[model samples]
Target: MSQLRTILICDDEEELAHELGEFFEGNGWKVDVCVTGMAAIEKLRKGLAPHVLITDLRISDFDGAQVVSVARELPPEMRPLMTIIITGHVMDTARAVDFMCDYLYVKPIDPDVLLANIGEFLAHRTFPAAGRS
Candidate 1:
């Protein structure tokens, strides 16, 4: 059988991260949850390439932009199919322009809406090979 699709969710809030992880898992996707941007970066650098990356803008250790930058620096084949930014703060143009993230969601996101978006992304993307990032 084919492997389940995977997602990486980075957020400083443990509850939110756990909630989102559980939500994704409930739908049959493999999920990795990180409570800090640095931790997420470490995972990515270690070559855990998930199909979708959903990160909070303001996170402990570093901001989401840095995490995205590191992910982009990986080999092209290892980059995530899409990057989703979820932030409670106002989005700055410079950071926004730099990342060119695929989706943006403000704070107080509805889990159902996020799940729908993930489903759409999964349907459209051709995922990369497993075990490389």
Candidate 2:
């Protein structure tokens, strides 16, 4: 059987992370969840290349924007990684406009809307290996 691409979700909310992780896994999307921004960075350093990153704006260790900037510094081959930032703040939404970030999900994350918007962004970045970033 073909393995599903891995997805990394960085959020401090324990319950939401677990629920989303289960949902994604059930849908054939391999997932890894990190409760802190530091852990997320470490996961990446350990070579956990994910197809998508579902993060929160208010992570304990680092902000979503910082995470995005750091991830961009990775080698080209490690690039196609997508990011979706979920926050309860409107300021976070406005700041996200500066980046080529794929998606921004505000608080009260509606599952239906998230999946739909995320799908649209991920589709474009899902290029084959040889295409690299």
Candidate 3:
């Protein structure tokens, strides 16, 4: 098997974070879980660039928007290829667009859908847009 696809999942809820992390890891992806937006940003700044980032909108330290903002501020070569925000709070459609998040999933998310969405991201990365017309 090839090297695992790396992913970072940030959520203050320890159980949820670990659950999502384990699910991704079980599927052969390397997973890193952070309970705070600052921690997530610190990890990214320290050169832990994952292929994707899945973050909850509301956390103890800072909102997911901040995490997305920090991610975007990273040097282009260090940024994650895709970002997905999952939250139980009211959807902030504008923030999603402004932050350049590829997708936003509401809470009580369906694991199957999340998995399928992630698979699409990996495929998209593997096949660049140059392949398109």
What would the per-residue lDDT of candidate 1 be over residues 1-133, giving only the tens digit for each residue? 1657788999999999999999888888889999999899989888888888889888978888788888888877777877888888766553545556877787899989988877786686666676633
Model 2 residue 12 CA deviation in Å? 0.8
Clashes by residue pair, model 1: none
Candidate 2 residue-wise lDDT, 1-133, digit = tens: 2435677888889888888888888877778998988888887766777777778888878997677666677776665367777887775337556654667767888776776766676665644454221
Where is the poorest 10-residue window by lDDT in model 1?
A: 91-100
TM-score pick, better of 1 and 2: 1
Q: Order of candidates by TM-score, top first?
A: 1, 3, 2
TM-score of 1: 0.87
Which portions of model 2 show Cα errors greater than 4 Å?
1-3, 92-95, 129-133
Model 2: weakest 10-residue lDDT segment is 124-133
Q: Number of the top candidate by lDDT?
A: 1
Off by over 4 Å in 3: 92-95, 126-133
User: Residue 59 of candidate 1: its Cα lDDT?
Assistant: 90
lDDT of 3 by residue, 59-85 (tens): 899988788888888877677788988
Worst 10 residues of 3 by lDDT: 124-133
Angstrom error at residue 41, model 2: 0.5
TM-scores of all predicted structures: 0.87, 0.83, 0.86
